[model samples]
Each structure stands twice: as structure tokens, then as C-alpha cells.
Target: MGALGAGIAALGAGIGVGMIGSKATESIARQPEASGDIRTAMIITAALIEGAALFAIVVGLLSNG
Candidate 1:
């Protein structure tokens, strides 16, 4: 069960990161002048999503331990 939970967390994180990358690329394409700002925001959002996923995986581990 813990392994399953961890896998789900990772899958969610990967999807979130992929979406962020795709959107960031589209935004940059549409507004090349603001690519710098878009990239910074994308990085921050991806980092936050990763942190939440990390917390969830940790909880799953502790629960099964």
C-alpha cells in the first residue's frame, strides 16, 4: 500500500511538472518578451508542486513503517 501511494505521488508530480513545462513554452512563444518572467514563475510553481509530492510520499512511508 505504501509503495502504491508513493508511486501515485510521483506520477502526480511528473504530470504537474510536464504541464508546467508545456504551458511555459506556449506562454514564451506567445510573448517572447516576457519569457524570463514566465520561466521564473514556472520554476517556482513546479518547485511547490514537487515539495507537496515529497511530503505526500514521506507520509506514505511513515504510515507503512
Candidate 2:
């Protein structure tokens, strides 16, 4: 169950990051001048999502232990 929980967290994070990247790319295409800002925001958001996923995975493993 712990492993399953961790897997789900990873999957969710992957999806979230992918969506962020996709939207960011679209925004950059629409506004070439704001590409820098869009890319920066995308990276920060993706990092946050990854951090949360890591925390969740740790909790899940600890619970099992």
C-alpha cells in the first residue's frame, strides 16, 4: 500500500508538471515577449508540485513502516 501511495503521488506530480509545461509553452507562443516570465513561473510551479509529491511519498512510506 505504501508503494502504491508513493506511485500515485509521483503520477499526480508528473501530470501536474506536464500540464504546467504545456500551458506555459502555449502562453510563450502567444506572447513571445513574456517568455521569460512564463518560463520562470513554470519552473517554480513545477518545483513546488515536485516538493509536495516528495513529502507525500515520504509520509506514505513512513506510515507503512
Candidate 3:
């Protein structure tokens, strides 16, 4: 169960990062001038998502342990 939960959290993190990259690319394409801002925002959002995912994985591992 712990392994399963951790895997799910990892999958969610992958999906979230992918979506963020895609959206950031689209935004940059649409507004070349704001690419810098878009990239910064994307990075920040991805970081937050990653942090949550990491926490979830840790919790799952601890529960199984």
C-alpha cells in the first residue's frame, strides 16, 4: 500500500509538471514579451507541486514502515 501510494504521488507530480510546462510554453508562444514572467511563474508553481508530492511520498513511506 505504501509503494502504491508513493507511486501515485509521483505520477501526479509528473502530470502536474508536464501540464505546467505545456501551459508555460503556450503562454510564451502567445506573448513572447512576457515569456520571462511566465517562466518564473511556471517554475514557482512547479516547485510547490513538487514539494507537496515529496511530502506525500514521505508520509506513505513512513506509514508502511
Candidate 4:
């Protein structure tokens, strides 16, 4: 069960990252002049979402161990 939960969490994180990348690309394409700003915001958002997933994984490991 622990392994399964962790796997699901990882999948969710991957999906989130993918969505972020897709939107970021779309935004850059739509506004080339603001690509820099959009890319920075995208990276920060992705990092924050991934950080939560990482925290979940860490907590799972500690509990399972």
C-alpha cells in the first residue's frame, strides 16, 4: 500500500510537470517577447508543485521505514 501510494504520488507529479511544460511552451509561442518572464514563472511553479510531491515521498519513506 505504501509503495502504491508513493507511485501514484509520483505519477501525479509527473503529470503536473508535463502540464506546466506544455502551457509554458504555449505561452512562449503566443508571446515570444515575454518568454523570459513566462519561463521563469513556469519554472518556479513547477518547482513548488514538485517540492510538495517530494515532501510527500519523504514522509512516506520515513513512515514506512
- Where is model 3 more than 4 Å wrong at Cα? none
lDDT of 4 by residue, 11-63 (tens): 89999999999999998999999999999999999999899998887776667
* Candidate 4 wrong stretches, greater than 4 Å: none
- Which candidate would rank higher by TM-score, 2 or 3? 3
Provide TM-scores for the models: 0.95, 0.95, 0.97, 0.89
Candidate 4 local accuracy as lDDT? 0.88
Score residue 20 of candidate 3 by CA lDDT: 98
lDDT score of residue 20 within candidate 1: 99
lDDT of each: 0.95, 0.95, 0.96, 0.88
| Pairs with backbone N, CA or C atoms under 3 Å apart (clashes), candidate 4 | none
In the range 1-65, model 2's lDDT, one tens digit per residue, is 99889989999999999999999999999999999999999999999999999999998888887
* Model 1, span 1-65: residue lDDT tens: 88789889999999999999999999999999999999999999999999999999998888887
CA-RMSD of model 3: 0.5
Candidate 4 TM-score over all chains jointly: 0.89
By summed lDDT, which 10 consecutive residues of candidate 3 come out lowest?
56-65
